[model samples]
Target: MSEPTMDHHRWGMVLARPRGLLTAEPFWSETADGIEEGLQHTQILFFLHQVPGLQEELEVYRRWSAQGFVHGVILVNPLVNDPRPALVDQLGLASLHAGVETPAPGSASIVSDNVESTRRVLERLHALGHTRIARVSGPSHLAHTHIRNTVSRQIAQELGISVRIVAGEYSEESGRRATAELLGLPAAGRPTAIIYDNDTMALAGLATASALGMQVPDDVSLVAWDDSASCQLASPPITAIAQDVHAFGRTIAQCVRRIESGESSFEVPEPAHHWLRRASVAEVSPPR
Candidate 1:
């Protein structure tokens, strides 16, 4: 019996942390759907790996590239000092990256304006008189997370507001722990507003606040990033920064198609992040 050969007609997307952002909500699923819809003739193959090392993951991509299993690959959640870009270039493969602004010269990139978006979030909090704000951020190593954190601190200093940030793994458990720690601070030192890097953490924060007998808005205002249906469905409906994941997916797919056609480098318009005001944030009142 002979081994089956590679399928050059297929495109690949490699993702990590599939449990939280990927399968926990419909946003990523919608993105996947959009990708397939955009590529009528090409089959999209999704590889979700639960690994602790990125080098191992890159090895998988390298093998696929060498075997010609996929025409191109999409990489997400880029890290600082990312080696994947160089690896892909060495392999002579077409690649696209999300959550990264400046990819390697030969690869394309899709990314949101994190600086502008973080400034907008801080501005909103400041307008509500949230002088002390706390942020529950995702992993510190990810390029997107670093961008958000840096911009947040810079904006807070400019606004003359105090800000505290705690690291999380973008999981419900991490969210709960971060929220508990933030809420445990002395009343005078505690933040009046809290922002989460994603909806899962925001939901956990809501639950943690409830357990502490704290009222939303009245005690602590809450905001979430990467808005999804889950955010709107939460009690009081979390305030969030919304991005069109479906459109983002379609754009990546289009870029992949272009790369497949021998285009070396091109730009894909990243979806805009906009704040959606809801019941979670309220104007602070002066003490009696």
Candidate 2:
């Protein structure tokens, strides 16, 4: 006769955005199971795969949490020291409360260690006889850009190789523009090899080289960081670092579980960077 004692174990959740980078269905289904098992009045899960960026969506999660729509939120891709810190801080200050609130009082992030990954990738290029290499980095404001550029520069300097850098957004168009800029440089000033932050940029760079009547490996070798599907079908089939995106998604879901159990910090093994050797690189010959 007692109103069924509210399931104290129930804790609702709100997920951040599109989870998979390489594939989706597998993680979506696994995450759905987590949601069902956690729905016992102690948990209620609501995912936001359609939301824009981290800060904006965190605010939405706070609103719904305050209205009892969800007890907690499972967010992703919250790059720290972000350009939009003010927005994130403001939302955090507004959401602090008795029980339902931003769990950590700030954005919690789970991301691949991009800097170390890039460093290893650069080392791979160096081993392949790429001495004079250039970098096509992502936008300056993003944390991934900062990490990749820092590692690239540090490694290039240590190896005594000349490195050139061109900045662009993480889009194919940005990659095209950056590539054109590199090609515009005099042949004497240009590096013999180019590395891009993502597969999108690498693929675009290949097109730009073709437009300029240049042959990859013979004219300029190319390497990309993220291993996307398009990277494999390019004329020469780009060499790239293939990440386990399915593992990334599953890790985020697991982080949420730990946070709910009063464990504020969870550590994941840094992703190891591997080079997929293809036809994009060529051996350099001494000048006559």
What TM-score fits each model?
0.92, 0.73
- Provide backbone clash counts, one per model: 0, 10
At residue 269, candidate 1 shows an lDDT of 57
Q: Which digits, one per residue and each the tens of the lDDT, describe model 1 over residues 1-288?
A: 565466655667766553445666565677787787778666555443444457667887888877777766788778888888778768866678876766556557775588888999999889877889999998887888898888889998899888899999888888999999999999988999999998889999999999999999788999999887888988889999888888888887887777667776766658899999999988885440
How much lDDT does candidate 2 score?
A: 0.61
Worst lDDT window (10 residues) for model 1? 43-52
Please list the residue runs of candidate 1 whose C-alpha ends up more than 4 Å from where it truly belongs after superposition: 1-7, 18-21, 41-52, 286-288
Report the lDDT of model 2 for residue 275.
74
| TM-score, structure 2 vs. true | 0.73
Writing each residue's lDDT as its tens digit, candidate 2 over 50-69 gives: 45455556566556534544
lDDT of 1: 0.81
RMSD of each: 2.2, 6.8
lDDT of 1 at 103: 53
